[model samples]
Structures are given as structure tokens and as C-alpha cells.
Target: MRVIKLTIYEIIFIIVCITINLFKNGMGLERLLLPLIIIILFGNLFCKSNLEIKKNREFIYAFILVFFLYMSIQGYYDYTNVSKNNYSLFKALLIQLPITMTVFAAYIFGIKIKNFNWRISLTSLLLVLLVWLSIEILPIIRYVRLNSITDLIKLIIINIPIKIYYPSLVEEVIFRGLCFSGLLAIGLSEDKSNIIQAIVFGLIHILNYEQFSINIILLIVPQIYIGYLIGKIYINTKSLTPCIILHALLDSI
Candidate 1:
């Protein structure tokens, strides 16, 4: 019964994703198919999450739930907030208060990055190149277009401090670095975990599109894959440094 429930829940999520995909009518089915591929892979490989995360389950759930609440609220504001007195930025920051609070609380509560500086440096350099090179060479990759790649870079560099910083970094750290990896540590494969994470990432933007825009599949599939890549970096490196740096670099591109 538990397995059936989980499977049914996942099926509904995928159907919604597909509904958004077909309705958008812009991108190819290829993008839509990617997540299905991931789901199958996940069922085969990572369905049984590791028992270890159970040890720290309380901290993980608390941290993730808090981040979820903050992001979910801000995501809504990003869609519905109307500005008159130039207070949107301030209001936006106010919405983001949870991220700062969580990181500090997590620290005080004994969640520390094990190797600190060394981990940060190595991940930073590698992610800078990993994401940078991928975007730079996209023309030859047969997957992403050059302009799209450039737009990604521009978003990271230009958008971060000016329009969206804490949201991207804090959310990605929690979702990709924390939720995604924690899932993988037990039962989810890298690919399975990535798309699931990315779908949530993409959903945060769903309403921002005009009611008719269906290009969401393109957005969602890449996000999930990207989440997976960042998760892989953190898991292998045992730190979030590379994932954060690569994410910043990738989104910037």
C-alpha cells in the first residue's frame, strides 16, 4: 500500500508536468520525455532511500520545510506582487528572511560543512569550468542553443545581486544540495533525484508564465538535470561549494 501510494503520487506529478508541457505547445516532446526517463531510472535505482538519512531526518525535514515555505511564498510574490512605491525589492527581501535565518540556525544547531575552505575553493573552480564550458560549447552539444546558453550566463551574472540572489543560492542549496542529495544517499539515483528536484524548481515559476505559455517542459527538464549535476558534485565532493559555484556559474551563463 505504501509503495502504491508513492507511485500514485509520482504519477500525478508527472501527469501535471505533461499537461503543462503539451499545453505550452512550444518545446518538443523530447524535453517532456526526459523526466519520464528519470522517473523510471529512479524507480530502478534509488527507490529505497538510504537508512542513514533517517538518523538526521528531523534536522533535514525541518530545514527543508522551512526553506519550502519561504520559497513558496516568494514564488507567489514574484507572480502576484504589484509595486507602486518602489518597495518591491524591500518586500522581496522581507520574504526571503527565512533563508538567512535557516543557514544561521542550522549552523548553531550543529550542521557544519566538514572541510570548509578547501571544499569551497575546489568546488568553485571546478563548477566555474564545468558549467561554463558546457554553456560555451553548447553549439556543438546538440542539446542547448548558443543564445539560450548566453541567456543563462547573463541571468546569473546580472540577475543575482540585482534581482535574485538569496532565492537562487539558498533555494538551490536546500533543494539540490540538501533534499536531492539526501534522497540520493538512500535510494534515488542521480538522474532520478535531479529531475524531481528540478520539477519543484520549475513549478515555482509556473504561474509567472502567461496562462497559455507551454514552454515550461523545456524549463523543467533542464532544471531537474541541472539539479542532478549539482547534487552529483556535492555528493562526490562531500560539500556544497562546487554545487553552489557551478549553479551560480550555470545560471549566470
Candidate 2:
């Protein structure tokens, strides 16, 4: 039975991330207390577990039931939305729900999906931040100057959660958690698994574009590198926490 542990830096980093987001959303001290308390309690419920439960018939059945329910809901939404010509970014996010549910199912079933370590989380975040600053900051600065502060803040606030939950959480759970791990489980070498998942991750982005073109190729090339970097992080750390947080930050900005 392995215990999930956090270092002081990791704990502080998590609290700071939550606090800044709350403050940005206009949560003052008086109103903040309750939400913060609730968040802490909710987080504890997930993090306090020893993750030692043995697999059994009941767990397997429950996993299948929940996974099917998630897929059904997602399928229904896609069918309804696409038929009405009302497919939105929000609706598109539903595509990720099945993968997200699969990750949750693994957690609930006491499968050791990944390790969460403080050093890995912190290092990953910092490295990604540096890369983002170098490559993405200029474009963001130009955009910021053209928009009102309030509008920019509103945009960030609205998009942060979507970015976090969608491409960040969902993609990592799929490529890194499922694809990478699944390959390793089948006795593939780590290098081979990492490369395969990264390529698949990049190839999947083709669905984002309407049709294949040179432009799509140009866009996907970067995504491949990004996927590779993220996959490498997962291989080294065996954790998705840093990948999700850093990927969300990149998309949000």
C-alpha cells in the first residue's frame, strides 16, 4: 500500500494556485473562507486515501457500469448537438468525458495509475513555465495590449477551467495515463511507448481542423513536440498532476 504524499512546496504551490484563481474571480476574504474550506475538504476526500484497495468482482462491475454510463452520456450529447448544428466548444469538451471517466474509474478501483511526487510536480511546472515565457509570452503581451483588463481577466477566468479539464486533464489521462501505461503494461519498452503515445497524441489533433491541409500539418508538428515533452515528463515522474497543471496554464495564457 503506497501512501500519497506531498512536500511543503507542493502543498504551498497548490494552495497558491487555488488562491490566485479565486482572487482573480473576485472572491474577497469574507466570501473566500467558505469556498476555500469546501475545496480543501473536497481535495482531502480524494487525496487522503491509501490507494490500497484490492481488485474484485464488485470493483470490476462498478468500473464497467460507470464507464458505460459516461460513454452513453457523451454519445447522446454529441448526437443531439451535432444534429442541431449547435456544436460549441463546451459541447466539444464532452468528447473528453469518457477518458476522464476512465481515469476516475481507475482511481476508484484502486489501480495505481501514476505517482504524485513533489519534486516532479514542481520541476515540471517550472520547466513548462520557462518554455511558455520564451515562446508564448510575446503573443500574449500583444493580445493583452489590445484588450481591456476586465475583458482579458474575464476571458482567462472563463477559459482556465475549460482548458484545465479538457485538453489538459482529459488528454493527459488518455495519452499519458491510458495509452502510455497501456503500452508499458503490454511489455513495450519505455522509449517505444513514449514515442508512440506522443505521435498518437499529435495525430489526434487533426480532428480539431476541418480538413487536412499544409496548415494543419504546421500546427500538428508543434503539438507533436509538446506531446513528446509531456510524455517524457510522465515517463520520468509517473505522475499526471504536473502535466495537467502546466498544460492548463499554457492553454489558458
Candidate 3:
């Protein structure tokens, strides 16, 4: 077998992505081991070669540039919010505008965006509904309590745009557009790239819990599955639109 060489940017890109997820919440030695171990195992499984990396150096550079720019803006927003204890629409816009522009540019450049296909779109939508009903609906029903129809409507109205733009659009762009497509562009097989991105997607949710435990680790399993499904949708449709819509609908619930 031929040896696969990774470019420096490729290594930095991978490290930055992992580091962002691992340390995003806070540094805790005890909380780090399990997720770190899992990440290592997944990395070994998926990132066994870098021939693709060498061939796709320009794409790697572009991906790194875009990812870092997004993170920098996001870091600024987070810093200002924490320091000032003020959450203003302007502050939020500072972050969202860059993300919106990045996603738009990504689509315009065809980085995971494809020509519209109604059959695939419809199938993707059906899959999204099935996922919501089977995996998400029960928990939502159990946990979400609303006072009245007006309140429900208000919540939906307020959350739909936020959920769609931020998490759905931002995450789909990063994981599907950058990570998954970047891997594929660099020569990884579709299966390996999908699993790796999905694992990273799931692992990042570790930050969502205040405290770590085996149970908290277990909860991320569903996220991995969801990420895998989203990756599959992107692969099938050759587009981010379905993936973004699916993610938005899921989060909106």
C-alpha cells in the first residue's frame, strides 16, 4: 500500500476542528478522556490516508480560511456577550451576517450545493419528517410545555428563523459543506468521510452538558446517527439545501 502524506494545513484544520469542540465549554481533565478516546478511535478509522489531502491543497487552504474566519467572528461575539452581559440584536447580527454570507458563497460556488431536484428533495423531506416523529417528537412532547396557542405560535415564530439560520445553516455548512465535502475532495471514500464528520458532529455535543458522565456520553449517540443521516442526504442530493431544511425542522421542534 502507498503511504498517504498529509499537508500541514490538513493537520491544522483537523486539530482546530477537534480543539474547538473539545475545549468550547471549558477545560476539565476528567471530562476529556472519554471523548478524546472516542475521537482518536474515529480518527484512526477514518483518516488512515492523506493522498487526497496532498492533491487538494487549495481546497484545504480555503476550508481552513473560511473555518477560522467563522470561528474568529464567533469568538468575538461570545467574548462581548460574556463581558458585557448584554445580548443585543446587533451583536447577534455581527455573527450571523458572516455565517450567512459564507453559506451563500459556498452555495454559489457549488460546495455541496447542487442543482435542484424535486424527487430527491421530496424524499429528503419525508426522511426528515420520519426522523422527527420517531426520534424527536416524543422527547419534545414530554419536555416542552407551553401555556397557550398564542404562546406556542410566538415560540415558533421566534425560534424558527433563529434555529434555521444559526444551528441549521451554520452546522450544515460546516459539517456537510466543509468537513464532509472537504474530505471527499481530498480523496476519502464517501463512507469514511461521512462517518468521520458524523462522529465529530456527535462529539461536539458533549459541550451541551454541564457535567460529564457516561450517560451524557451515551446521549450523543443519537446525534451521531442524525449526523450520519444528514451526511447521507447531502451525498444523495448533492446539495446542502435538503440537509439544511432537515436540520432546521428538527431543531425547530
Candidate 4:
């Protein structure tokens, strides 16, 4: 693995990018640009040599194309939200169907699947359940006391697509697949990669920040902390499927 570190110039560039991201709400395109720049710069840091590339032509091509597609769809979604023209949850999910389908297609056609470790996945599932219960158990009890089983089932069915597409697949592909993997490829250790990506995951929620307050800190902490768990799971499993399911389950409950 090629380990690359930021030079002074690259650090300065990142600082500038962050400054631009701060104005992302006021200038919508800046949000998109910052992520693209990040992916390109960091991704290229540990890219393979020409011989390696030639040997893995198919894999490299697919990976690059899919990464770009993921970035584009995510950028558009961010743009819509920032511009205050975001679709309803249901409609937004409907819009994501095509993009999600494309991503799955790329995975199927471009990548090879190896042995998946179900044990690691199960551990991830347990962690997800624990996390969910910690946050939502009280509300869930209230809901159960007030609602019938049929009503609960209906609610779950209705939210399934949204939960799967948003928090599970799309978000995982972007953060764990793109950001975390890119960091690892650039020679970061697993722990460092997880932490960096988790922090970035948390910072993205700043877009939803209403004001500087204790509540904002609380909101960001959970997102970042959960992101760290998800990243660690992805690294352990070397597969996104488990994390996707786990994330959807967490969000649904």
C-alpha cells in the first residue's frame, strides 16, 4: 500500500476548500465543488502505477466511473437541499431510484465478490441495534403503547425504501466506500481512516445547523460517533452490504 501524507501546499489547499465549504449555503455550487476536489486530490494520492493500472484495467475503470457517479448524485442532492428545493422524503427517494440502480449495476458488472464474513456482519447488526435502542427505545415504547401492531407494520413498510436508500446504501457508498476507502488507499491506518471519515461525516451535518448551541454539538456528536462505528465495520468486513443493511435497520427503528 502506498502511504501518502499531505505536504504544506496540500494542507493549504484543504484549508481553502474548507473555507469555501463554509459558504456553501450562500453559494450552492461550492458544496459540490469541495467534495469533488477532496475525492480527486485524496484519491490520487495513492493511485497505482501504470503497470498496476494496466493489470487491473477493468477494475480501475469501473471504480473511477462509479466514484464519479456517486459524487454527482450526492452533489445534486446536496444542491437541492441547500437551495431549499429538496423534494419530500418519498419523492426524493423515488428520484434516487435510478441513481441507486446505476450504482448497483456498476457493482455487479465491475466488481468481483469474494467470501463475505457473516460473523463480522452480525456483530455490526448487534451494534446497530444497541445504538438504535439507546436513542429510540423510549420513543418506541411510547409508540407501541399508543399504536397497534398493524399501524407499526404499516409505518415500517412505508419508510423502508427511504431508510434503505438514504442512510443505508447511498450514504455508505459515499462515506465508507468513497471517503474511507480513499483515505486508506492513501496509506492511512484503519483507525485513522475511520476517524477522519467519521469527522467528515459529522461535519457535513453542519449544513443542517440552525445555530451555534449545545444542541448542535449533540446532534453532530452522534452522527460522527456512529460514522466511526460504520467505518470500522466496513474495514473489518471489506463489504458494504452488511453496513447498508445495518444502517437501514438503525434508521428504521
Candidate 5:
């Protein structure tokens, strides 16, 4: 299974050549404002869902309302927790809100939501509390190395479930759900579109930094491939269910 997954990952990796355009000014939201807005507008305009977007704005709004409420709670948590305050984990979740809420709203309205075999999304998220606590309480797990006071604190900080989940969902929807599927719907073939979208998703992380090192490329490699796998799982199963689980598991491991 590992080998097969790696071969498919390699094929997609080949379509992508690495070109690190370093940004020395440091990352900021302003950098992507115009382009990101344009993409959001375009996707909202043309996305083909089972719901009549114009007619179902109310449903969409309701979902966004709930989502925003959750986000507000997360933000409050961030304000209270010093480490979270530094990470802007709430703000990171906030950044992806507009699109993620839209996809979910569409799902609520009987869209062309895919039907998969295993049929589970957020199962991994459900396990997060257990996995995270295990990392703390258990001693044998390799990733659970509580070497120092600060390290232990960081482990607690990073392992927060809401910190992990909301952003992942937004990323999957924007990258795999919208960009990949939208491109495929227009003209790009499933594999090509997926691979390209995965590349873009991976690039978002690597390029957001000031300078892209070879190590950065290496770090992004597995993630990009995982993004590709999410794309493939969505396309092949014709559902978003597995993407969520696969992504959560990859991050968990």
C-alpha cells in the first residue's frame, strides 16, 4: 500500500517542478488580498452544486452563522491561551471561513456531494481528543517526546483539536473541493487537475515563508503528496469523506 501510494505521489511530483520564489518581506494577508478575493468570487459564481445558490442563500447564511459562532469561541480561546495567541490559530481558522462555510452550506442543500464507500468525514477528528491525550499520557509513542518543560507545553499547545480541525476542513474544501473539482468540471482531467491543485495547496505553505529552503521542499513533499491523495480520494470515491479522514490521519501520524 505504501509503495503504490508513493508511486502515484511520484507521478504527481514529476508534473511539479520545484521553483522557490523567496519572499524576504515576510508573509502577510495583504499579499494575497486581490488574487484571493478574485478566486473566491469566481468560485462562488460558477460552482455547480445541487443547491440553487441564489435561492438558498438563507441556508448558506445559517450555516455561516453557526460556523462564525464557533470561530468566535475559538478566538476567545486564543485570547486566553498565550501560545495560541502567538500562532493566531483563531485567525488562521478565520482566514478560510468564507469558502469552507459555502461548501458546507451547499452540502446542506443537497448538492452533488459525493457518496463514498467508507462514508466517514471527521472520524479522525473525533479521535483527535484520544490521540492528543495519548501523546501526553503515553511514553512509548515516537512523536510523544516530552523532553523539556517548553517542549511539553508546546505539545499541549499544538495538540489542541479545534486548532487542528477547522483549518484542515477549510483547506480541503478550498484546495480539493473547489479548485480541483472546479477545474475538472471546466476542462482539466481528474488526475491533472488534482495534482495541480495539490501542488498549489502545498505551495501555499512553503511560499508563505520568507525563504524557501531545500529542507522546506522536503517537508512539503509528504504534505503535497497527501494533498494529492486527498484529491484522488475525492475524485475516485466521488466524495469528500475520505479526504477528511486521510488528511486528519496523516497529520495525526
Candidate 6:
């Protein structure tokens, strides 16, 4: 029952995402199938959730707090930037608020930092690194050929803020923390929660890249697998710390 509700909610969430994307792209209703891949994955993996959100008031409040905090920061950034060049702060909020709120919701729901197992975490990190690198080997080689070691170092140094927020902290918290944890709390098994949330995580990247092409299509599988890896680490350690490190490193590389 609870699981059924969550599944329905997930489906509705996907629809909302698709609708938002269509509006953003100025596309028609017919192209909705492109994003339905996410729904398909969820439907195939659907299971009844026994966990209840009503019991999770603390999590909800935390999510709200984080969401507003992020929005405020982004609003400030937009205001400062736009003041310099007549930019539209409202437009920035319109574009980013949904995604930002979603990620923060996941962070509040999924992140539990009590148990820390360095051994298990390091092992998970290594495994995720291998998987990420293997899938990205071609790109890695191309990057190496294009940039000297110092250049790579400089790039990492310059993009530290970006790598931490976008790929590492925010992504991991949303996927592994909110999606995975919320599923678990709602009575889904660990494995089912991981796979379903992973698929959604991969699908959310559609918005991140702001393109709905075959490249994004090709990315779902790897992203799903990567999401599973991160969820697994979170499950083992009962913490988001390890997953955040692994996700950040994967994105940075």
C-alpha cells in the first residue's frame, strides 16, 4: 500500500519532469516517450512500500530547511550576477528551483552520518572508481591527450567549488540519500530501493545536461549502475560521506 503510493508519486514526479522539459524545449506532447524510459524503469522495478512518510516529520522539515537555504544562496548569486549586467533573478529561480528543491529533499531524507566505516567505504570507493573509469576510458584517454598533467591539476583546482557542489555533494545526497533513503524508509527493500532510485537519478541528469538527445539516452545505463554503486556504499556504511566522496571523484574525473 505505502509502496504503491510512493510508486504512483514517482510516476507523477516523472510526468512533471517531462512536462517541465517539454515546456523548456518547446517540444510537443508526442515526444514524451523519450523521457518515459525513466517511467518504464520504475514500473518494471515497482514494489510495495511499507514505510510511511507521515511518520517522518523530522526528515520533511530538514528537507524544507535545506531547500530554502540552497535557494537563498542561489538567489543571492543570481542577484549579484544580474546586478552587474541586468540579468533576471526571477528567471534563474524559475529555471533552477525545481531541481534544487528536489536534490535538497533527497539530502534531508537520505543522509545519515552516524556510522562511518573507512574500510568498507574505501573498498566501495575503489570499486566505484573502477566502474566509472572503465565506462569513461575513451573520454579519459581523450582528456589526457588534450591536457598536460599540470593542466589537469589546474582544471581541478579551478573547478573545486563546482565539483564539490554539483557532482559530489548535491548529486550523491539526492540520489543515494533522498531517493534511496526515502525508499528504504517507506518499506522498500535495500536492493529495490537502490535500483529504482538509481534509475530516477540517471533520468534527472536529463535536466542537468539540458539536452534530450541520444547521448543522454546512452548515458542512462552507466548512470544507473553508478547510482547503484553509490546506494550500496550508503547502505553498507549507513552514511552519505563515502557516497559523496565517490560521486565527487567520479564527476571530477
| lDDT of every predicted structure (CA atoms) | 0.49, 0.55, 0.57, 0.55, 0.46, 0.51
lDDT of 2 at 210: 58
Instruction: Give candidate 6's whole-model lDDT.
Output: 0.51
Clashing pairs in 5: none
Which is superior by lDDT, 2 or 6?
Answer: 2
Better of 3 and 4 by TM-score: 3
Q: Quick one: best TM-score, which candidate?
A: 3
Q: Which residues of candidate 3, in runs, are more than 4 Å off?
A: 1-58, 79-84, 88-91, 102-120, 143-154, 203-222
> Per-candidate TM vs. native?
0.54, 0.55, 0.59, 0.54, 0.46, 0.51
What pairs collide in candidate 3? Answer: 52-186
* RMSD over all Cα atoms, model 4: 11.8
Backbone clash count, each prediction separately: 12, 0, 1, 0, 0, 5
In model 3, the Cα lDDT at residue 110 comes to 40
Of the candidates shown, which would achieve the greatest lDDT relative to the real structure?
A: 3
Cα lDDT for residue 190, candidate 4: 63
Candidates' RMSD to native: 8.5, 13.6, 10.7, 11.8, 12.8, 10.8
Ranking by TM-score: 3, 2, 1, 4, 6, 5
Worst 10 residues of 2 by lDDT: 46-55
Question: What TM-score, to 2 decimals, does candidate 3 have?
Answer: 0.59
1-253 in candidate 1: lDDT tens per residue? 1211124544565565566546653444555554344333332222222222222343455456655655555556565663223677676577566544554444543554431222444424544464445443443344344346566555556654632356555665567655665566557655566556666665655545546344554555445444544544443444455456666555543
Task: Give the Cα error of residue 220 in candidate 4, in Å.
Answer: 2.1
lDDT of 5: 0.46
Model 2: residues >4 Å from true position, as ranges? 1-99, 102-123, 148-154, 212-219
TM-score of 5: 0.46
